[model samples]
Target: MPKKLYNIDFYKFIESLDLHSFTVTDVTRYLFETYSKEFDNKKNATQFVYRHLKRLSKEGIISAIQGKSGKAIVFRWCTESSEDSELVHRTEIYGNKTNDLIVSQLQEKIRRYKTEMLMSVGETEAYSEWVQEMPDFAEYVKPHYQNTREQAKLMLGKVKGFERLLAEHEARLS
Candidate 1:
């Protein structure tokens, strides 16, 4: 069974850090390889950063300041708190309404998906094409058919009498 990833208290940890603020990319790489060593799915550094910023902003533990370059949100930790303070209550700077928009979009997608799954396909569409039409599935499988000649040859070699196999397969289909 695959392990479930619980949402982390990313903001609290951000608060714990001594720096005024840091880049999300830098933080995620640190979190993935360093703190969250057990979790290896760190490829979405931007998502991780966005989610953490949203979480932290909701709690008021951190604030997103205009980046040094301008127009970018560089997250900076709060400094007004007393040095001895431990219990911090961070409220969502951006409200559930923002999150609601995302949820509603996802819900709309799920509704569309359920509706789509229940519907029949066009006469010209193959089942593989149907699956590949999905954004996630399409992106996931786009590279699947991208084998180089050498790799294709290697894969072909792995088959037991692939030529004969194809002939038999065609015969069976016929």
Candidate 2:
């Protein structure tokens, strides 16, 4: 059976926001713990996040609820349109343009293909060539796991290097 890919972006957007009104301290904690969706800065907190949250209010995703004494702003999730669901009867607010399901699927496919390629190509040199392509391959793959698929098709569009390497390994073993 095939695995179902979930739409995480709608949830991600909700996760990114401050559900309740927050002061400087609460905002800091929210940014640090829950959402890495970029609150102006991931590492530092200052007027940047506060300012941006204010801007978000203008976009209708958040509303600045002014109480009697303390000014507390509660941000609401805009569930308007099929973007969130078919149940939205309100105005559109702060949903992103596209969901992250596609990006996640693409990455998963790439990973599965790479694993298959490694099993098929049976030589260190061929594997090494493939692993050397990604800009962040070193960080992504473990230290012991070294394989890549960048040294691509020949002028004839065949994976000649990989085939040659695999054959060389076979011949040596024989």
Best by the TM-score measure? 1
Question: Clash pairs of candidate 2?
Answer: 130-148, 130-149, 131-147, 131-148
**Span of ten consecutive residues with least summed lDDT in model 2:** 148-157
Q: What is the TM-score of candidate 2?
A: 0.29
lDDT of 1 at 26: 61
- Predicted candidate 1 versus true structure: per-residue lDDT over 71-99, tens digit per residue: 56777766644434325332232444555
TM-score of every model? Answer: 0.39, 0.29
The number of the candidate with the highest lDDT is 1
